[model samples]
Target: MGMRVKQLSQLRNRIVVITGATSGIGAVTAAKLAEAGAVPIITGRSASKLAAMRGRVSGRCGFYELDVTDNADVQRVVDRIATDFGRIDVLVNNAGFGLFERFEDAPLEHFAKMMDTNYMGTVRCAKAVLPYMKSQGNGHIVNIASMAGKLSTAKASGYAATKHAVLGLTNALRAELAPDGIAVSAVNPGPIDTPFLETADPGGGYAASVKGYLLKPAQVADTIVRVIAKRTPEVDLPLSAGIGIRLYGLAPRFADKTLGKLLNRK
Candidate 1:
């Protein structure tokens, strides 16, 4: 673990607050950060699951029950964390879910819910942590966006919109926070083998079609850990997916005919 140690050296004793951390990528990240000597503070809607995560994570791991959609709750939790930790070194906004439904078939409430939870939830948490980070003179904010934000496909218009908002917020915050010694990063990962797929594609057809390309939760968790250490601006995973996003941007017509058609499997 020499290479791993070198990568995580900067994180020793840092306090990392991770939202939606009871399972999946967030869960793995908490454990990995703990191994790197960072104090991992996990949050989720389920108090029971949060306790379980604290037990599972190595070393000192704290947890809080958080529902990011609630603005007051977000402020309360973040304040409590800051008071306990003295300073918040990093915040990973990973609390989000997706649903795949055609624009015409999807209910308006679904889109609103996604926007409220995925986008506004991030806004609330980021705002809550600002004063603490600003006072400390340094901090990192990592938002777990998605490839769909860049390249929207069929049956995911609502979900894609939410991710797109997250990406936009991340980019703007990076610029705004630079002078304050704060770094913002966006992790745009493709499909990962996690409960996320279960919610996004309940039928499992999309997962079945994309099985070979699906990334493991740890793969994304590792990237999140690295980005915190390096403070990278943006990271798009799975070289192939990155290539497709680039190709789509460069030649939309050609990509739509080839890559877009292939990816519209959902």
Candidate 2:
């Protein structure tokens, strides 16, 4: 307990930036980091929603209006944060959406939007912060990927594609930034009980299938905080899910048949 407290104390006053912090995992993470005494810098597209989230935080927090898909805007906000805080200790790229539909039925525009916001948005933020982190010689970049990144399902083709890209980017960045003393990590959480489900699968088909296995936003936030403090390379929430995904990777044919039966996939 003593060591744990000491470890958390290390986050005190650290400038931790979280994107998409107005709701869901990002919002919960901001509050959790604030409890650990870190100065949470939050960004979201909604001004009123961001203000409400800031008001809910216990400690001093900064909020910015940002749309991660906008490269210039991402750079501007990151620059302002770096200037205001002197250095950004950590960045959590959590601003992304999901579209769950069969590949044939999915719209092309949705594919473009997911790639732009989910994959390239992460790239923009990481690129914007790298110079500052390189100058400081120490920083952490945490990408909020998904279990889908590791394994794709029937209706999540587009979402999975973006997450897979995220995983690839994160792994390569980890190798590239290691020499600079900057750590890169990926948090691949299974389905969580949040507004994301509503947005991703408005028809409720996928949500209903995974309702029993859904994790809480706070649970994911706790994992994010631990990942940052420990500099863990990759983590999948709910060990059982991670184990299943690993097994599937080892035996794709057998696992796909089994998972298809279990998930009622066509």
Candidate 3:
């Protein structure tokens, strides 16, 4: 293995609540966690997807079709997790998706949906599990974000906004929950080979452009498991992509100009 597996005995039996576990990074990560000895509870809006995932996981995993945008549903499922599993050691707020419409040209509803799923979805999960984690005095929250959070994209403006919100939430929650022995972290990854590419670019343009740079969902998932397995506060899936995120923040205009040239933007 190219990644370092930390010697953490607390990984097994650690009730891992994962959102967006239907497919992509969430699906792969849940399986990996189970293989490494974790009781992973997979959640997704697609019942079929959720069922399929639970069926395929490495162990006898639990399933929940969760709509993170709804507070009542989020609460019910969270309560069930605590009542059934007893204690939650990890919460992966990984459910998110977006449409690529021009920022100004798009209707306000588009942005609202992005916020509901990406921002509020994350907040809902964190809040639902916070009491349990705080009471136990130990937990880890992993927020799945994108390099877009630190960088930017013309066609992906709404998605970037949501991911940035995730990053912001993760950072603030880390400081707020530190005293409670809870670790909050954000994972910023570059383009990955998954249905996300299809969702983000239904026309397949995202793939056409990011060709050689696209990383595998399993690879990203592996990193996610390690982050939780070791309780790392922040994780950058591929260091190169993280550097790009950092550089983009340092010079937004330059990054924008560079991306335009790279993607042949008009």
Candidate 4:
């Protein structure tokens, strides 16, 4: 009897900020949130893309050119949003990327860039917005992680590290912010066909082997909007992927052996 789909429409008037909203899952999610009646304030690195996306979403959607990794830029935007909207009911930390290469062959700069944007970006945004969300005594933060966060995969060590960091942050924040009526969650999806994986080289056979299981960016967006409106602590887009994570989490060595087998088939 708790708030179901019919009652979730109460979020229509909420001010929600979505990062990385120019393209990929973030953009699609921005549009969907508009449809669901939330005032979606979308952000990305490019002002042009944000403007274009603002024109595309359905409801009261705005755009902010945000570089999430930069602390000053993040604080500037968070302050701006609080000043303009008075409150941010939701913050979606979906701005992140990854490169693919063997750890030995990979350039240190690329890995550094990944951690800065993926891990530091989430941390900066959460810190910047915590006071606002805390003062309001109610808020939700949804971090778009990946199945990679829960398992080891070839050529994704850098990506996995960032995502794992995010998951850790989400869990810790959830515990710390519980009494404040704030909710923190990590949404982990498997193989969503987004620009996150459009690196120069994947350097892994696993990705190439299973091209069909990939979901679209819009699909991931659908699940994310659901997370925003509901108080779900954790959501795995595909139920099967959740089961797989548990299986691998239970026996990492066995999972790695199976991964080798799967890759050999490639």
* Candidate of highest lDDT: 1
TM per candidate comes to: 0.97, 0.97, 0.93, 0.92
TM-score of 2: 0.97
Q: Give the higher-TM-score candidate: 2 or 4.
A: 2
Clash pairs, candidate 4, are none
For 122-237, candidate 2 gives per-residue lDDT tens digits of 99999999999999999999999998898888788898999999999999999999999999999999899989888888888777877788899989999998898788999998
Name the 10 consecutive residues with the lowest summed lDDT in model 4.
198-207
Worst 10-residue stretch by lDDT in candidate 1?
254-263
- lDDT score for candidate 4 against the true structure: 0.82
For candidate 2, give the lDDT of residue 119: 95
The per-candidate count of clashes, in order, stands at 0, 0, 0, 0
**Candidate 1 TM-score, C-alpha based:** 0.97
Pitting candidate 1 against candidate 3, the one with the higher lDDT is 1
Local distance difference test scores for all models: 0.93, 0.91, 0.85, 0.82
The residue-level lDDT of candidate 3 at 55 comes to: 68
List model 4 lDDT by residue over 1-266, tens digit each.
45555645867888989888898898888888888789988889997887788578886766788999888999999899888887999999999887766688778888899999998999999898889988999999889888778765667778888888889888999999999999998899877776666652455454566677778888888888877777678988578878977887788788777766652221
lDDT of 3 by residue, 1-266 (tens): 42443443457788999998999899999898898888989999998887677567887578988999999999999999899888888999999987777778878998999899999999999999999999998999999988778766677788889998899888999999999999988888888888887777788876887788888988988888878877788877579767766787788788777766763321
RMSD of 4: 2.5
